[model samples]
Target: MFRFLTAWIRSLSIRRIPMKIIVIGATGRVGSTVVSKLAARPDIEVYAGARHPEKVPAADNVTPFHIDLHDTKDDIKESLPEAGKLIFTAGSGGKDLLQVDLNGAVKIMKAAEEKGILRFVMLSSKGSLTPDLFSGKNPSPLANYLIAKYYADEWLMNNTHLQYTILQPTALVDKPGSGKVSLGNYTTNETSIENVAEVLIGLAEHNSSVGEIIEMSTGNEPIPEAINHLS
Candidate 1:
């Protein structure tokens, strides 16, 4: 009986933790930060695809690859897989957010569909909902970009089978992370890129379906405390 108990315990402990995830735009400002945090975990299988794969931090577990968003679906398929989580943190590196954010993402989504990858997470900016209405043109300079993001977010929302979480951050700033955050519509008076990086890692580890569009702002939320608010 003791042997039986030991065997059962071992079985439970040995359950494989799934780590086959593709971190798109892994070389970007936020993506690189996320890469650093996940690299330490032995259980995670991270594919850090970037435009410049060589730029990724050297880590044993991270598999870096060249993933240019400008590539066609066929080209993208070669770099992507059929079933796994995909976190898109890549931007066009220009205001051409329309081509990079919307079109590039759509191409990836198409590849995922062919491969049957349904789980997804995205980093989006706030207030992108206006273009879907009668105004054929986007509202602001970045409106075209916003509309593109807004529509993509909407498609994910409509699809129930796919588990998705959309994080809409305020204007991204470069500062150290204090860790506390206020999940509200108001943009933070100040927001550090480090804090944003921390939050993205938190999202990856925690699994919750609180699928509301929460806006993050700069505040005095402590680091350990902000880490806890991921749910």
Candidate 2:
């Protein structure tokens, strides 16, 4: 009877363990917001990954993880902590597209796979799905950035076995979030950074939209409702 009781207690203790999630690019505007949101949950341990770990905000349940996307595959794998879910919201801002935007994202994906982190959520840009649209009459300066995102997203889908959700939000504005969003293709090309962060949080916590490429913008539906409505 004592052995049986001990076995039951061990199972209960394992069930009570908090979920660990890592947010890459935790210092960025959207990434920082994600870190703050995730940290508020008592059942989650948030690892805020950044090139400059010092920049990560101080909060309970939040730990600063040092990660340089420019590092080699082995270094990146070594740097990553063991976590169940990972959110990739880092970008190069067109400064070093090849290194930061393109290769950096790919390297992290590979490392995440190697580390056995199964769930991945990528914050991408709108129009990334249609790279050829940027060409012809008027080429946008953001063509390269979109292209990088395209391939990174493709690799996540084709090259790796990680369960991934790629979120493509339109042009981001600095407005506050309404906790509402529109999922799927929309005509408007504007979405608040706050709303994007909220959507990312929903995706991470709910584990919804796996193996899906979601295109989102500011909309009328509540964030939770919109996420739940995903098929």
Give a tens-digit lDDT track for model 2, residues 67-175. Answer: 9999998999999999999999998778888888889999999999999998999999888878775778776778889888888889899999999999999899999
Model 1 global lDDT (CA atoms, 0 to 1)? 0.72
lDDT of 1 by residue, 1-231 (tens): 999999999998998866677888898888887788788877888889888999998988888988888899889988885336777788875566667787787777777666776667777776655464425564465666677788777766674445676777777777777777755545465567777766666665556523655577777666446546655
RMSD of each: 3.6, 2.5
Off by over 4 Å in 2: 1-15
Q: Note the residue pairs that clash in candidate 2.
A: none
lDDT (0 to 1) per candidate: 0.72, 0.89
